[model samples]
Target: MKIAVMGAGAVGCYYGAMLARAGHSVTLVGRPQLVTAVQAHRLILEAAGRTEAVPVDATTDPSGVAGADAVLFCVKANDTLTAGRVIASHLGSSVPVLSLQNGVDSAEHLQAVLGRPVVPAAVYVAVDMPAPAHVRHHGRGELVIGPGPSSADIAEVFSRAGIPTEVSENVKGVLWAKLIVNCAYNALSAVAQLPYGQMMKTDSVPETMRDIVAECLAVAERSNVMVPGEVMSTVLGLAASMPDQLSSTAQDLAQGKESEIDHLNGYIVRAAARLGIAAPVNRALLVMVRLVEAKAQSARR
Candidate 1:
């Protein structure tokens, strides 16, 4: 399959590297710096105490997605529509476009913009881009994608490429579950400037996470989204799952770049308000991350 990875950020780079290493014709469309670095030394995957170079084509043009058999849309949630617009004309009419992004509505947003089917995947991966061409993997890299005309085939393709992929009928619930998990951990890690394992060891962090998840579950209940599984257990288990990985928000703040905090906790806050439910914990986390972002922005200026 000719796969196109649209963002080339941490998640995009990790999956793209895996797919390319599996012998597929993979192309990464990213920033000029990434394209230049890849052209010079190739894409690097650092994981599990080892590293290897992945073979893939790289380009800065959105048109690089042209003629791709499948597309992985991996931009931040905030850039969903903008990136969708940029690549809409280039994607084939029937190609499967997977939104491997945070938040619940990216696929819906992209589908509207592209006027095509966009698969929504609940991506669980701990990875970060240490350099323009280097992606460091910390832990789990599984995808739970919602049903689509081509979801099964795509899932099989990913599985063959060493990516654990599952096709689920209750994708809405899956996305909501992921949103709640982010609500529990992301802001805390960002505020503490710590990885999951270290942050979880701090004082009263488990309690704080419980409070946050309680509020999130209330919101999910009010929204009538059947978020499956034992959420509390899942939240508690994350630190162990990706001990060395920092939250994406933390990475964004460290880089002095904007994050998808608004889409994560902020989305829950909005849902709570709309449903006449209280979400103070979620609201507080959202406010705190926004302040951090504001401070980071001011520092840059």
Candidate 2:
């Protein structure tokens, strides 16, 4: 399959490298720095104490997506509309685009912009870019892609590439489940600059997470999305499962990059407002993250 990965951040590079290694022709469209690094040394993928350079095409131009059979839209949630606009003219109407992003609304948002079908995918992986063109995988690399005309075939390709993929009719629910987890921890982790283990250990952290999850669950119920799993259990288990791992938002904040708070807790806040529901806990977290981001910006000046 001819694959194009838009964004080429840690998530993009990790999955793109996997597909490339599985012999799919993959082109990564990203920033010049990453494009240059990938062009020079392929993509360095580090996983399970092993590192391998996976060769794939890399470009800084959105036009790189033109001939792709499928495109993976992996940009941060806040970049969805901007990146969608950049690639809209270049993408074929028939090409299947998958939003392999954190937020639940990205695929729908991108689809609205592109006027084309887009599959929502729940990306289950812990990855980070330690350097340009390099992706370090902590663990778990799988995806649950929403049902679409091309979902089965895409899932097959990804599974063949050792990505552990599944095509799901309930991907939205899965996404909401994941979103709830993010709402519970991402802001707290970012505000504290702590990994999940330490963040969970802090006083009142568990209680706060529970409150966030409760608000998200209420919002999800009103939205008619059945968020799977016991929310509190999942929220608490993440810390044990990825003890030393920082929330992606925390990592982004630490790098002075914009965190996706607007999509996580902020999404819940908006949804609650629309449904005439109260989400004070979620709103508080969203506001706190925004304040932190604002403070970070001021520090830069």
Candidate 3:
């Protein structure tokens, strides 16, 4: 398979490396630093006290996606439209595009921008870029892609690369489930600069998480998304499962980079307004995170 990964950050590099290791022709389109590092030393994937240098094609230009049979749109939520437009111009209209992003609406947004079908994927992985072209995997690496004509073949390709992949008919529900989890923790963790375990230890934190989860659930129901499984347990279990792990939003804030609060809690707030429901807790968290982001930007100046 010829695969191209756009915005080759943490998640993109991890999966791209795996596929490259599996003998696929994988191209990673990313920043100059990453492209230079990859061309010099290949992609360094570190996990479980082991490391491997996975060789793959890498470039800083979106044109690198030209010959790809499939594209993994792995950019952050805010970059979806811009990256989609860039890649759309270079890639063939028939190429399958999978959106492996944080938010529930990324695929739809990409589709609107590209005027093509985009498969939504629920990514169950914890990864980070410690340095240019170096990807660290913290936990699970599985994907649930939305049903489509090419979904089964895409899932097979991923499975061969050691990533557990499934073609799911209920991808919308899967996305909503992940969204609820993000709504519960991303902003709180970012604001407090704490890991899930430490933040949940504080009194009233669990109750506050419950409030946020309830609001997200109401919004999901209003949107007709099922949100399968017990969402509250899933939200709480993340703290225990990855006690030392920091939310991606927290890492973004600490690095003075933009956080994805707008797509997480802000999404809920907007959905609530459309449904005539109040989401005060989610709204407050979103506003607080935005204020922190603004302050961080000002401090950098």
Best by TM-score: 1
User: Candidates 1 and 3: which is better by TM-score?
Assistant: 1
Q: Tell me model 3's lDDT, rounded to 2 decimals.
A: 0.92
Candidate 3's displacement at residue 90, Å, is: 1.5
RMSD of 2: 1.2
lDDT of each: 0.92, 0.90, 0.92
Residue 25 shift from truth in candidate 2, angstroms: 1.3
Can you write out model 2's per-residue Cα lDDT over 3-77, one digit (the tens) per residue?
999998999999999999899999999999998898789899998899999999999999999999999999999
Off by over 4 Å in 3: none
Candidate 3 per-residue lDDT, tens place, 136-253, comes to 9888899999988899998888898899999989999999999999899989999999988899999999999999999898888888888899999998899898777788899899
Candidate 1: 10-residue stretch with minimal lDDT:
215-224
